[model samples]
Target: MTYIKERRRILVVEDDIDIADLVTIYLHNQNYITHVAYNLEEATKLLEQRRPDLILCDIMLPDGTGTDWIRALRKSADLPVIFLSSRQETEDIVQGLELGDDYITKPFDPDIMVARVKKRLRPAPSTSENMVATGENVWRDGWLDLHFDRFEVRVNGKEISLPAKELQLLFLMASRPGHVFSTDYLFERIWGLDNWSDVRTVMVHLHHLRRKIENTSSTHRYIITVRGIGYKFQAR
Candidate 1:
């Protein structure tokens, strides 16, 4: 199927001129609109002018580390960020993940990077629009209500906030109630095929999601674990 996608805007923040140009070239070839920033200062300036759909950043910058910049960015925006740096240490990768959506080691393949960027920009697939819709762009099942346009979730009329990845995961499962999603499926769907991270990441996020949405006192659980398989939303 030939899918037509809107040109996604991407901000590439890398001090290395050659790397920045290389990334921008690849992204442009994929039909993405890109703005290159040599440092965090320039990136910040560009952000003030226009917000990009995604950000590609390097950890070491001329003015400050990308980690520090991202820490500050998180205070205001939830823009998906992918770290493109040479830092391959376990600690560095974990730290990047803690702040951003994904991390990529330096000297990365342009093809893989573009693929990851596309995955991040793509919206979660829904089985049927009417199946999930209670209202325009809204999904409701009993006390759980999800507003796709606003990225808001309300349980029992009280609003609850979730991280971007968790929200996407919930939307995917809840959109197709009773459909079992294996760990591999969920990982690839939410984290993307370019992600080499362990599948255990799925388990950790599921645990946190369950805690947020599941009402222990009630017999009804929003998300049900299909042991030895994966997980599914409890059918109404």
Candidate 2:
């Protein structure tokens, strides 16, 4: 959000002088510590010097395009980014989506702009309130074990290697054992964007999760789909 930067850091990569100034002014009003770069060299230097929480980059830069920058950044990091460009064509939007979170056309409204920024800026709720840990790892029944401090999980007494998104999905579900989470709710809480991704993706991950951790013969599958509703992790 352009208005609240207390816990947020932002990188704005735009080659145009006027637009870059506009972006900095808006972000400054929001209280976010903002850095502006007009070229890939400056952006790279800023990246190596300061780690921003999110990046807003223009598609066309003096040194290179946003797509190239995205490809480079994603090689080592997972920072969310929103593309800013004058190109409004479908292909342009699609290409931008490949970059990250959201895309906005040149003539964007500040309110909508700030809203999208805020959505990505907010942090996810933790597994527990005590950010500081006591060192002992805990599990909820043999179904799921969380290393309260490490944010690691164990299922069926075996450690499961899950992708980033799947790991987030599992941790959120196990945070409240047996609590059924609707697709919309899960998407919002886990992905930070409501309906941004298809429900099928969630289903696929859950299916994979079950196959990996649950026995078909067991009456209680660790993650149970509610059919018409959504899914829940069986507490025990």
Candidate 3:
């Protein structure tokens, strides 16, 4: 049997032909399949025909605002939406974020734009059924050992206890090794979207988790902060 990876689809909605084409070219360079829509009308029609994995939308659309479109899009789909707008006002940025996952102001670096998209589309921090069945549940490094099945954590060869939430956070990061998980993603996955605890809760839990797993006196770190991004388990 042959296996082929499906390319992730991205919909770009921008009225500027130059910007739209440039964004499309950059997405294509990364091997992601992209569809361009010049306005909200075309974007809506394209969405009806084919739902893309993610969307890069402009705020100032010919038909309507990206924020309004996102409000409607949220009714049907929970996929990631990134706002690519020239609206530089604080209120505009905040509003865009409230309605979308990310907001990139105009004259944005193409590399950063692609990076944000990649981060948003990363594999969710969940162990798959196959992994569970295969018993790929143990993670061991220099001084840290985790038995996810039993929720047992050993540091420096001694068993230690962790709060339920902390244990869960550790397990998720360890499972993926080096995958970056944004605060929003981690909070949603672990605490759940309905949980009242904000993203800061994730930071607090990770801080405690690091203290527990990492050698307090040493300079080595197991959980690395990606700065402006989130955290990743650095197994070495």
Candidate 4:
């Protein structure tokens, strides 16, 4: 008996026909199922119909910028998004990275693009093995709860969607509460050396993580800044 392996589905959201075709070709060559959407409206419709494993979105779309669309998408889904845009300015890249898992500039190598898709789609560990070797899978402290196995985070009894990287950062720190993880170390640990993004990516993700986990009304902070050092998770 033989079992068929399901090909990972990827949504290619780009307005340029040439670019979209080029990307679809490369993705297909890698045995991936690809769906092409020219604008935000089409992308939205496709999203509603098919759940792709990953998305390669162009920042500038016919209906709206991908950044704005993803900002809204993040409210419900923690799906992985990679921005494929020609806008190489610092501000544009920063804004894109703030809302996206990865940003790849245009005129990118098809090989590199396929590589990134593979990286993002790589399977994570099973629930039983998702936690740190010595850390508990579930952490519940009055106001916050982190379920590592389920990749779920609840604050004040409300569940919130945390992107992949943000969840990883939270779990890493939470696994060994009180241990200060330097920005450089955190960046290297989460993003890894293969990524070309700057170290500030760590700060960006950390800011977003804090916002989701910490209540705005309360003065309490689960992740404390060490002033000159890095950050640490304080359960107390």
Candidate 5:
């Protein structure tokens, strides 16, 4: 058994030696402790040894596809899994989105891939609960501050424009700052599993929220990275 110390450990599961090597190297460069697996056996072995914070998997492997691994993992673990695939079929994409954390098509931009991974791993801090809803009123920065009954997210002493989903997600997160919630959790809360809310959908919504709130703000970045964990709403 490997004695693990760091919290932000990542697993890159790919059968292609070259691709796996490249991913492992890049993740290492980002200062994220990483482990590589070439097939189901190796991947399972690594999982048994130490659970990683997140997993990046290629859908197709020599022995099986990433879907196979995800199905198996879903039976026992909720560890985030991002699919890396050569095929860009919608069905495949949807299936993966439904099954995993995120997906990247073949010949992907390493920077984008890294950014996605980092964003998904971002952490939210402790915050009090007084949620703002849509069409109500909330202020952030020097803006309209248009939000209803959700949580108190003051942008420069005002509220900002918020969509329904964003409001719900923020409300949930703000209710408990520094509480990490996975994309799956977000989906379950916002869209519900029965409704087909998947990881990719959650990512898209988070992307929008981050752009609207965090990226534009000069101070008080509300969401911080948690490495391998999920997001937590920042307080102060």
Candidate 6:
């Protein structure tokens, strides 16, 4: 009997040939379709050919820094990125975190890298099964209305557009109002089941989401941070 595997395409952007080959071998072992790009130029060509499910990038490249590449890519693409680099300094890690979804220091374990990749590629939970319905793909709470199918949110009849990730985060929290979600839980549920040590990913995305949905003048916020815990949706 033969079993066919679902290949999740991954773009590996690393200048070092040995490191790129090693990472590609590991990703292939995990049944992922891996494409290697030696620099930003090569990566750009590969991206034009086919968009990968995720990107594993090195901070230092022959042509330019990964930070610059991702900054430009984010303008058009919403693909998840993980930074794998030898630069483990606080500032370097913070820079990677700000630009990408996840960051890994160099001399990393192959298993851990594969795990992170798998998590990023994990399919989102079924919206139809889990979402609380107002009507069709819509979920409503007074002035705040979410149209999941349309990926549109309306606040007091005013429609606001959000990035894909931000919109998903809002839908998850708003679906279960008053339910407090821990960083780990939200990370796995929303971002996937990788390492939660770097919870900053959740914070950054949530901050962006809040900016879009939260009314500054209003005393009550739609999404409330639970201090020591995570966050919950509180409709006012």
Residue range 1-236, candidate 1, lDDT tens digits: 23343346788899997898689768766655577778888789878765678999999999999999999999999889999999899999999999988999988999999989988874534335313324344555677776655778998889998998899898767544454678997898789876578689888998999899877888657778889999877744
Task: Write candidate 5's Cα lDDT for 31-83 as tens digits.
Answer: 45466777877788877765677889988787888898799889988877889
TM-score of 3: 0.51
lDDT of 5 at 73: 86
TM-score for each model? 0.51, 0.50, 0.51, 0.52, 0.49, 0.51
Task: Evaluate all candidate structures by whole-model CA lDDT and list the values in order.
Answer: 0.79, 0.72, 0.80, 0.80, 0.68, 0.78
Residue-level lDDT tens digits of model 6 in 17-97: 779868976876665556778899978987776567899999999999999999999999999999999998999999999
Please identify model 3 stretches exceeding 4 Å from their true place. Answer: 1-4, 122-236
lDDT of 6: 0.78
What digit string (tens of lDDT, one per residue) describes model 3 on residues 65-85?
Answer: 889999988998888999999
Steric overlap count per candidate: 0, 5, 0, 0, 31, 0
Give the range where candidate 2 is weakest over 10 consecutive residues by summed lDDT.
129-138
Error of 3 at 28 (Å): 0.2
Residue pairs clashing in model 4 are none
lDDT at position 91, candidate 5: 96
Model 2 residue 22 lDDT? 76
